[model samples]
Target: MPGRAPAAPRCAALVGPYLSGKTALLESLLFATGAISRKGNAKEGTTVSDSSPEAKARKMSVEMSTASADYLGETWTFIDCPGSVELAQEARNALLVCDVAVVVAEPVVDKALTLGPLFKFLDDNQIPHILFINKMDQAEHTVREILEALQAVSSRPLVLRQVPIRVPGKDGDDVTGYVDLISERAYKYHPGQESDLIKMPEEILPREQEARTAMLEKLADFDDHLMEELLSDAVPPKEEIYQLLSKDLADDLIVPVMLGAAEKDAGVHRLLKALRHDVPGPEVVAKRLGLDGKDASAVIFKTSNQQHSGKLSLARIFGGKIADGATLNGQRIAGVLKMKGHAGEKVPAGNPGEVVALGRLEQAKTGDVLTASGKTPSGYKWPDPLRPLFALAIDVENRNDEVKLTAALAKLCEDDPSLSFGHDPDTHELLLYGQGEVHLNIAFDRLKNRFNLPVKHRRPSISYRETIRGQLKQHARFKRQSGGHGQFADVHVEIWPVQRGTGFEFHDRVVGGSVPRTFIGSVEEGIRDYLVRGPLGFPVVDVAAALFDGQYHSVDSSDMAFKTAARMAMQEAMPKCNPVLLEPIYAVEVAAPNEFTARCHNLITGRRGQILNFGAKDGWPGWDMVEALLPQSELHDMIIELRSLTLGVGNFAYRFDHLQELTGRLADKVVEQRQAAAAH
Candidate 1:
């Protein structure tokens, strides 16, 4: 035992939409595996996964939690991921390091569309996954109806592994047990206890046979021998069928669907057994990700801030064994920890395929590859983080807490890469971006509770531009006599709007040293400074200033004098030049399922958007991409409304396109707001 290589540990991630029973399923799995003597309830704040204070208060998971269990002499790690779409980045990173993912979902047909993004990600990455239909006892629809709805969103074939036994009841049809289609065995479920093996029911024999035949037919698509046996009308042995199912699952060719009610601990044992048999090991994933097999390497998929411990880096060992204090990439490992809920136990060494926390890997962040050779393989592709969907302008409540807030924000972004914050130069406010409003609220909570830094947040201000529609020529002089030398400088300048986006040009057309060659640059600088706040209380663009004539005192007229004079000239002329306000326009592309395209169109138009076009998105079947020109002011909170219309799956990408003139009551309101702010 001392010299033998440790049996590789397999890791699985439990992921799904919010309130889909992912945490409950995790509790059931832990209970079934004997990892815990008794199960814990999420509603009671007693579950191992949702152990954080925020999650306990919210009664839902806000982050990824890890646990380990030993079943049948093999060690396995389970990462229970948050179900909120706002927290999807945690699950996305967890999926990359996992051998397989268990996509838990409730049995409502209308909610099937919520899995569209998750399904697409799995298929595109070629990650092996399974569908666990949770809360089956309370399902309003039959298994076939649920499967049909789920299959519509998944690109891979959905193979039903079990057929549920239902009995008519006064409230509804109650699911009592299920028949395994692969082994053709039946069992009756007992709450909080092991299910008893029962004889196959004669009433459901025909249905069981039909479901078993369908499973074989789906598997036969990849296996020629199985197809030939099916064609010859010969029965495949049970062992052969199991082997085919395992191989197909490991290859990510089919999605095997299993049924269970996590609250009752029903069908959980069967699901775990299937995972033990079919889930691929670290070697398979390593080969698929194309990491170097010769060196000791691992991937840091998650980072967290611990109360007692400083920083914990959660990673999957890919190649060789790493012990405590192991030097990797020029940093010494502080400690090796085995995670159990929020608490961790120190471990000496971690082997390949094991999910363990390496303490004080401060330089290591999420999605970084660690290799003993101090280099990464060429073209190694880490999972790409999803684009941010919402943003808020944030600032410290107390001016003294600014530095502490900055450090805390850096740590927060490091813990969750999807969360980002930066200072907006135009608005002069610190802006924080995330997946949605709830995502930002959770971040604020973390800032307050974890870092003890209180902050305020609001919608970001729009960046508007001011330009002229009419031309005017004016002159001004600045003569100041404080004590010594007096300041006397005068200039005549023509102001007019040029073509759009031809921002701020200055012409030195003064003849015979009328304004003096030495002070020309200073005059231009002064004019540029004036553009910072125009007559309309916004930055001026698409205008040119010419210094055609001016007068100056030989002794008093320095650069400062000419600069002051130029500012005076521009300030005097801009208000009479017919200045107009310009609002930012963005080119937006909204992506959603085809059925929601019309709704998406209406949403854009309702926001005063101009439709460019709509069509099928490239490489995405049954999805539409609608392009439009929308005002930047309207784009705020658009994702919230969009998700509400499209079942929480719609998203958009936008960039600043151009500036359009604003008029009518909307323009008047903007001007009034700007004037009031200036007055304040």
Candidate 2:
């Protein structure tokens, strides 16, 4: 067993808010592990992760990228995920298969609130994570102040492992080194080189002791033995402290806070060492995923379309080994690849806990669990994609490429579960839905750049229905006489308003058979056709029509004649009925931080929304839910406005509640717009 191959590799995902320097931190990690010879700067578009054309153009990560490293002869994979809230689906999905997540953040107090959603997700899933405070040299706040600000958003206890050492001779107070609280040892940082251990400064002794005591006390709360030792005034050993910290982190009971400046590669070496020692291995993560470690099974978490090679499915093997040409989910593995950024190398096999890209697995998709026997694992719960909050109506610019565009869009959705597209039944426009405007923009960019499908994007149309405000009855006869044949049919019908949401109804009251039995169905059909577009230039709803009296000529009164007569009667009656426009009202529920509740209420009311209720949102603490009835037309840009007011964390879900009458100037304007559109 001494010379046996190392166990399956462990994976770590880097996640945080936008512009938090996660990509730079990933580069530092790869360099520290000796995976890359030179570090790439994110701003210059030289990083291996953000290599896509869209990412380079925007200088931000729009999707997840995988890179593997071998540190100390053991394989470890680091997945760099996008930090933009609009692109959070990539982070969420990547975090699922990772053993631990590094939540990169700046040393700012107010910025802590932006991490609430990410913290809540990690805690809810019971995933182990650590906080890495980046850009320490440029920090504007003290470490203690930053930690206090972050603790408010997370449920887990925060354990500070290191305290920064300020260099005295700098133009301003700057962090040039750190003191390890656990070991009580100090070191001076050297950029792009190994840090030198230095004598513990005499002035900072009291501060280090205070921080160490606080960290120990937080850990003692969960350990009875440690608590007893602390109560007895006994000092715990360094090994015991580290073991407890690792155990607590793996259990999701605590989060260890580390410091680093990724741009200079300072403090990154220590961070890498910490990860190599404390991160969970394949066995622990496999058990957490509810999979037996003996079987050869894997779950596909990402899919990529390569220009030279076709489709590649990146999956994490949970058990046993998957070799080249192995069949899983009834599809043969055409190849096995080991990926580092956009470059991939062919590998003979993928073992448990390793992330590999299986070549040409066309049938496989994200969130799919596959086994060598082609049977899926039972009771495995995958994370559901978040509901789309933004939409755009889009079409191919070149009509000849419409079919190609459709095929490419399908592939895009398959790659990103959060991206979806459909044809609006009423508007007849192809609507693409996503998390936010930026999310949709990236989707369209991919259409043009990746698939070469030029597209035109615009806002979608609103659905408005019309109904009658008053009732009337009129009679008309369809009479046409030619030299040889004649078309003559007469009918009497009663039209009246119905309750809202009752929809269209047709009735027959011809007891004397004035309208023949065979012609009754045709009469109803004609009335239904007339309702499709009423005099108000919209679909008719909440109305009824009854055929009370009608006469048909025996010679020419066929179904066609009766149908034409019924159409004439409805056309003569509806204008007298006083038609009115009805706009859809939606029941909306908005969720936001407590501080933003008032702003949300104002947004709803400004859009003519009626407040129903407000209360604390269930399950999410320090958050409130506000319920209101809003017009559908007012909701098109509601998500954009809500996010701007709530630090990009607020969101809402809505459904059609009822149709309200649109009258006065608004109704007149709607009718005019409808007529103009119809003319076009």
Candidate 3:
């Protein structure tokens, strides 16, 4: 009987921290596979990935790019995801549909902490991944040291698959090639070409043996037969070792480590071979995602609005073939296009395991699972978008473009679920929320370049409230003689401060018909309207008002008269009530490596935050989670500074905790600014 054929199509995602060369690796992969005639340089703005104008200008990826290639007569799709922490959601969405993730990283020991969150996400989802240590040519430390640093952040064991063969060069030691531990073969790397096989170097024998032994021991931990052979001091067959490695990787029990300099195309072919042989097929992933054996089911991983082509939904077919004009989720597929970066070619149908863009999926969205029966799969779960950490109050430059801006924002938010926009209820300002300053700037760039909407933004206003401290009673009368039914009303109202967070309350203590029963409600309405903008120029809370005494003329005392009198009484009484400002406080939890836990505490304290408690983050070894109560005003730029101090690995989640009194010079300054803004 003939050996079973390889899986037809497989998808892999390239993900890592910023500046780790994922795009470079993508370019090398496409070039080595002959998908492109010549490799394009990222810095030169010629690469297939990162072809967006914004990415070219920044020399970094701001969005995910997909390309398909054929290696060894098997189809493969590679998604090159943005490496910036601000754009991590793009990577997360892409990883969910891929067969494996190529976690590209540098050999720098200090920057190894940056991979902590990515590693945790992958392992938590039980997604199979390979650690491709890129930029090996510029490595400053030994592979062992780099691996040790990386192993600290990863929950799974790091199985070293290749050991670098260093040679003397113009700049100290250089990685000329790598030794394959499983194959027991040596190769010499040639720039822009495949590595050439060579005899095992005599000096590399000891290191190679040690690494290979370690690899076998890790595999033996998952294989009892291999453990028995090791105990007997017997060498396992190469085929048996390869099988065990593949099984362990597919089970997400080990992270196979590979070394390469993607910019130079070294070790590219070997990585491709490993992907072709070891990575599981889409069926395996489908089963893992609870869609096994289902027919005509596909999951959309990305959604985009193109310049002229309209909306495109990129989906990975899980069970059945999707053809042009096929109905999915009650929407007819207008077209099926096989995507290669920004360009695509129309295809008649998309088969299982292939990533294809379905045109005009206006009703479909990212993370939606589509089926031919027009029914959703039960108990299916997709990741919710990340909580927005930064915000900007935005306005359209051209007032005439306000309607256009709303439609454009809808499209943008659909493309990137992490982005959101809405009117702040307290301040009445249209605010845009995103990951950080850079992320929002990119959204602005898209609005201008893609949608032609020029927008202006500023730091969002804090939702500060005013409450009274002192209690007092005042009397006022409204008597207007306009010749016809002149208004006449008299009232004595008492206002008092309530406990914090008690909100507002109104009581009608009028007796003996002093104030008419019908006009009493009008008095409360007028007082409530005045509270909308209090004497301190903020919404008033935690206060109560009562209509204690009042006199009204039967003919002249209408609801309007009593309302006007109530307003006059409040205006004269509030200034003497001693109002104060209250700012919102949030309970924040910051996660970072334990080594930086002290710095995190200082960061919180420096920003007027009260540390609650900190301890080890569950399931995340060598990491700490610090809890604190932080003022909302201090969090506008906190993410930027936190990332700066923690090597871009720290992150935080927060929710409104309580309202605290604001005083001192800071409070004075806020009131001054409010008055100044009101004057304008």
> In TM-score terms, which candidate is top?
3
Per-residue error (Å), model 1, residue 658? 1.0
lDDT of each: 0.90, 0.88, 0.92
* Alpha-carbon TM-score of each model against the true structure: 0.98, 0.97, 0.99
The candidate 2 region of ten consecutive residues with least summed lDDT is 1-10
lDDT of 1 at 371: 82
Candidate with the larger TM-score of 1 and 2: 1
What C-alpha RMSD separates each model from the true structure?
Answer: 2.3, 2.1, 1.3
lDDT of 3 by residue, 386-408 (tens): 99989999999999999999899
Cα lDDT, model 3, residue 497: 94
